[model samples]
Target: MSTNNIGPKRLVVGAHYGLKEWIIQRITAVVMVVFTIVLLVAYLISGGASYEAWAGLFSNQLMKLLTFLTFLSLFYHAWIGIRDIWMDYIKPVGIRLTLQTLTVLWLVACAAYAAEILWKV
Candidate 1:
């Protein structure tokens, strides 16, 4: 008995997250860019030249929601990119998992802090 390891009989193995992650990264980036544009327009329209003016700009419920969502998108974007880096560069499974875990924890903390500060405005 024999086995073939070339041509169409070749077996390929990998932890591939090819298309889905690519699409997610693109969507998240677009969301962040659109949010930035919206924020800039809002600021410009409001003439946010003072502390009170800045506060007033963010005081609206819609603005607060959009800000929170943008923060979440930013965090998720960072997480995906960092996770991919760890997965690609760190060959050891334990180290990669540990780094991914730490990344998740840090991003979650940042998102929570962002929410708190955003709502306070």
Candidate 2:
């Protein structure tokens, strides 16, 4: 019995990447929680019974900043999840690469558009 004849050795070692991913996910989760709470509170305060009221809430500088941050974090988290899925299940190298590239481009475009709109607020 020999190691070489058994199989290729695992290249990944230590917990650095896993730990980083976990930390990022948790931090984004917290941001989402806070953003949701604040958004709900603002909506409740505004009553949301009229379009004007909702518009007024969104027009605030603080609200715009929070909205931008929330979207950014959400986009990043989604990108990470999609990348992980592609790496885990996609067997074909060319197909996986294409999917990953498209995913990244789509996410980036959406994030940029969201940021631009937020900036106008």
Worst 10 residues of 2 by lDDT: 2-11
Residue 53 deviation, candidate 2, in Å?
A: 1.4
Which segments of model 1 are wrong by more than 4 Å? 1-16
Cα misplacement distance, residue 112 of candidate 1 (Å): 0.7
Name the regions of candidate 2 deviating beyond 4 angstroms: 1-14
Candidate 1, residue 52: CA error in Å? 1.4
TM-score against truth, every candidate: 0.86, 0.82
Which 10-residue window of candidate 1 scores lowest in summed lDDT? 9-18
What digit string (tens of lDDT, one per residue) describes model 1 on residues 3-78?
A: 7777787787663747777888899899899999997887798776788887887888988898888889899888
Q: Candidate 1, 90: how far from true, in Å?
A: 0.9
State residue 39's C-alpha deviation in candidate 1, in Å.
1.1
Candidate 2 whole-model C-alpha lDDT, 0 to 1: 0.85
Model 1 pairs in collision: none
